[model samples]
Target: MVKQVRAARTRQALVRAAAEVFAADGYAMASLPSISRRAGVSAGALHFHFASKDFLAREVEDAAADLVQKMAGEARSSSGTVLESLVGTTCRLLVAMAADPVVRAGFRLGSDPSRKNGPGVLAWWRTWVHERVAEAREAGELADDVSPEGAAAAIAAATVGFEVLGGADRDWLCEERAAQFWAFVLPRLAAFPQQAMATVTGAGGVR
Candidate 1:
């Protein structure tokens, strides 16, 4: 039992450290030695837990997937119209990626060309945006000119773009910056000016 506990703690540390490394450096650039050192564990211990760097990356990706799934779930479940949910979901995600290293790394790994055999996080986010926009269109929230596919594409692109930009300047992920995005997008996409602006400038925000 003690050995199991120790192993579990060690594994968690390795995952966190690996995430830090992967988040800072792309998967191709990240190294096992750096990860082990970040975890404060010897190379032998890292090997004991992960057979290779690929395996370690997979673990980091998995952890990131779990975090993203939870974030998306919360945004979906949050009380609001599809439009509001869309806005809130996006804001939350930007904030999360900015604040959380593991969340940031998961997105990086998911986008990395080397990781095959699994659906990527960015793909999953795009799908979510597509579905939400469809719901908004059905509810008569979207402008007649705003096709669901087009709106989804724009939002998905901007959201991912923010991730890329925020890596260098974290201000891109802040609520105020995200609010600016909503301010720009809502005008073009929302059918009702009052309702759309209300959602964007809402005190409860993303409600």
Candidate 2:
């Protein structure tokens, strides 16, 4: 029992360490030795848990994807308009990126040119944004001139930009920064700017 508990702990530590390294150095540049050392585990231990860096990277990406799915699910289930849900989810995501290295690494890994694998977390986020925008359009929540695809694309691009910029400067992910973005975009994107702004304001822009 003790051995099992220790092994689980060791694996968790390795995953966290690898996420930190990948978040800082991209997947190709991140070395196993460095990850093992960061986890305070021997090389043998890391190899026992993950045969190669590819497998470890996949693990991190999967974990990150799961987190995003949960966030999206929460937004869908919440008692809010599609537009309000979209704003709330986006703010929460940026806040997560700022505070959680694992989430940050997941996004970086998805965009890293070094990885041959397709974008994982990023693609999921884009899809979520597109779906939400489409739903908003159907509900008459978006401005008449706003194209669902265009709005989704712009929102995805902006959120990804925040994640990339936040890696170097956390201020980009702060509540004030998120509020500024929502305040500007909501006024332009929503069918009723005042109510949309009220929804975002009530949410308090990221905790």
Winner by TM-score:
2
Q: Looking at model 1, report the run of 10 residues with the lowest lDDT sum.
A: 198-207
User: What is the C-alpha lDDT profile of model 2 across 1-207, one tens digit per residue?
Assistant: 999999999998999999999999999899999999999999999999999999999899998898888987886687479987887788778888887778889999999998988898999999999998999999999999998889999999999999889888888986667778888888889999998888655435732
**What's the lDDT for residue 130 in model 1?**
94
Per-residue error (Å), model 2, residue 131:
0.5
CA error at residue 182 for candidate 1, angstroms: 0.5
Candidate 1 stretches with Cα past 4 Å from truth are 114-119, 202-207
Highest lDDT model number:
2
Q: Which parts of model 2 have CA positions greater than 4 angstroms off?
A: 202-207
The per-candidate count of clashes, in order, stands at 0, 0
Clashing pairs in 1: none
Whole-model lDDT per candidate: 0.82, 0.88
